[model samples]
Target: ENFFDFCIHSSGESEIKIKLFFISWHPLIVPIDEIYANETGTLTVCRFYTKGSLKDYIHQTKPTNSAYWKRYGRKSLSRVCDLNQIKNFGRQILEALNFIYDNGLVYGHLHSGNILFDLDQALPIKLLVGFVYNLYF
Candidate 1:
């Protein structure tokens, strides 16, 4: 069975309540199932989406110092930088962070890699979505 499904099945009333509270207010943040490690352990498993992250896209488009000018010519890359896109990215990230902090949870592993980008064809531009946990941290 899925880890989240298993969590929902096994979680106590308090755990369910907290999960519901977080989900209700922050629809963008997907909560994974809370798994217990063994009969008594601090570790838990939380599975998240496999969507492509912002770092992936940024890396794809990153230009070498020389390629920077070669691709767009002598003109600075700033000329091609879309202000609206940058603003939207910042706004969404801030909103996500604010929501997490408001819940008294610290999002320690924040980075472009953690920010998933929605690349659905219907959307006008890329949209930064939720993040997955970094176990290394």
Candidate 2:
């Protein structure tokens, strides 16, 4: 249910289109479904996914033109969280970083937008969603 607005170049020539899908296993990555570059290039696009850079999480106010609209009230994602939830999310992020480091890879980008929450389940699940800035050893 996500669409990436970026494209990749193959052999520094043709542009490659990539499609990714969210998998249920890990909360820090996804899998690329397909890849093609103007019918050329040798770089094989494997089953790869992107991880996000978690910066911060907070209830943000939606812009409503002026103070009049703001006086009414603001809406937010109705996910009530506790200390345990925050702790769990922290642990998950650490685990993901550990895995990346173990593989001699480093996360180049880290920000709040990179982190995702799967609210479909009873307990919202955290997910990392960007990797274009990752560095592999």
lDDT (tens digit, per residue) of candidate 1 on 1-137? 64434443465434544533454345454444553333222232334434455654454433223353453344433223279878877776777766665554345557765566554533322222222221111
Q: Rate the local accuracy (lDDT) of all candidates.
A: 0.45, 0.39
- Residue pairs in collision within model 2: 51-130, 52-129, 52-130, 53-111, 54-111, 55-111, 55-112
Relative to the unseen true structure, what is the C-alpha lDDT of residue 26 in candidate 2, on a scale of 0 to 100?
A: 47
For model 2, residues 1-137, the per-residue Cα lDDT tens digits are 11122222221223222222222234454334443443222232434222212221243322232352342235433234589877977777677666655543344455555555443444343444334322323
Candidate 2 lDDT trough over 10 residues, lowest sum:
48-57
Clashing pairs in 1: none
Q: What TM-score does model 1 achieve against the real structure? A: 0.48
Candidate with top TM-score is 1
Worst 10 residues of 1 by lDDT: 128-137
Using lDDT as the measure, the top candidate is 1
